[model samples]
Target: MAPPGDSDSSGKKSVVVTALDGVINVNALFTIAIFVGLSLASPGQRSLNSKESCQPGILTVKQLVIFEVLSFSFFLFSSLVAQAIKLSLNLLSSEELAHGFSVVVNEKILKAGMLMTAISSVMGCLFLMISMLNVIEIKTGMLFCGAKSTIISVTFLIVLVVSGLLVYISAAWYAFTHARVHFHRQRTGL
Candidate 1:
């Protein structure tokens, strides 16, 4: 076998590497950045005494900070796990490293990691949707109360949707990588 990330006779990079790169860079990194932004935006000890304070289904700043932290941890771990699996696969393809490593072990790890990533992505989607709703509620309340501006709410909504999309893409990418690895293993009778 040429290995998971190795180029074929055509000299093109393996699909696994390409897909993993896209997921890690475009999707995973973007999602992490969004969470960091959310955490930073948290009002901390500051209370919501503004006009939009009465909005329903809106989480307090403290709650938001906690939520963002959990989410950030989830995606960050998922990204690292995926990277580790990729690296292991690469190592397994190398003659020197393959001596003691079994493809079956790698497959099990990849499968488990993919499942975890998928679950995390689903949770992230739900979180983003909830945040979106909260943003809309705040925006609507502020507009009705004749607040100074809706820019913050609008921006948050945009970010939530964009982050949700990126997380979804990352999940799909993880699934694709899982499938590719499985196919390779099966084909080689590993």
Candidate 2:
């Protein structure tokens, strides 16, 4: 993978690189951008005295709240999925099934995990877009509400689903191939 912020020769920016490149250190950037925004716009803080004291701009406050909530939710969900994947992979590696059966099981679990992750990512992106639309000007909101954004969102969702299915198929194929090899070895006592 390219280092964060390093452009490839083709001049296309890698998502990994862009995501990693912080305007400041990662921790500080997230704190300032995410946590603070959440605290400021949290529904719990929307009281008479608190609202009077803060008096944040309506659109800005709404936008901040939307982004903060969506980001935090995504982070939590992703972490849980990652932990589950790790645990599943460990178990699959250690378990004893028929050689072919074991491979098939592991591959299916991996593919399922990947599909879950892709689904989570797509949902997160869709939520973010909806939140943005909620806070934008009328004209801007109208534009996004048009077929363009709808088409783009649908396209991305389709891609995510298809890619996930491909991963699953590949994993199953690997497992089947390995099992065949193991069966042959066992039969030959090699």
Candidate 3:
């Protein structure tokens, strides 16, 4: 059995691992959404080009493909790293393997993997957002103005997406700041 301090540390590490596992699941859903977006855009793009690659709307389709592919790549990479971290943690947690792995090494690996996965997940969302805008543009019209209705609808969607992103960022900022402050106070016995 671990001492009190070690128990606390292990508990915190377990919490982090659980959080990362949840993130991997969420990212998987986003990965599926990426494919869905591609399928939605594919019909229109195929009708437009299908051959003459130099077509006008084809370029937009290409850009959409680029963004979607990027989103998929980033999310996939994050998932891969999360899996690797889980594997490493599991291996190190075993009594036989635990002797060879230092706590510091495990901590460093967890922190690095968590940081990379977080960054990649955020980037993937950004790319997915951009691809979504492209989908809106493709379905609605060219140069963002097929009609007044299309313009208004796209505007509304953009506002919602941007607002959602702001909310997410704000929440993350608040959560991290409060958590750190609480930890500091606890450590200082304040």
Stretches > 4 Å off in candidate 3: 43-56, 95-102, 106-108, 146-149, 167-190
Clashes of 3: 0
Cα lDDT tens digits, model 1, 1-190, are 6455324411321465455565566446557555654743433233243543544333444445555556666666667766776676566555464444444434566667766765665565556455443344433443344433444565666687778677777867666564545423222323
Please provide TM-scores, in order, for all candidate models, with all chains considered together: 0.55, 0.37, 0.71
lDDT of 2 by residue, 1-190 (tens): 3223222311321221232232113323333445643545533333222223333346655775766577557644644564565554444433243243322224455445545554554455445544433323221222223445434555565577568657755764564455321111121111
Per-model clash counts, in order, read 0, 0, 0
Question: Model 1: residues >4 Å from true position, as ranges?
Answer: 1-13, 39-59, 98-108, 129-190
How should the candidates be ordered by lDDT, best one leading? 3, 1, 2
CA RMSD per model (angstroms): 6.6, 13.8, 6.8
Tens digits of lDDT, candidate 3, 23-133: 799999998888988886554453222233322376678888899999999999999998888776556555564443444434445566766887788889889888887
Q: Which candidate is the best by lDDT?
A: 3
Candidate 3: clashing pairs of residues: none
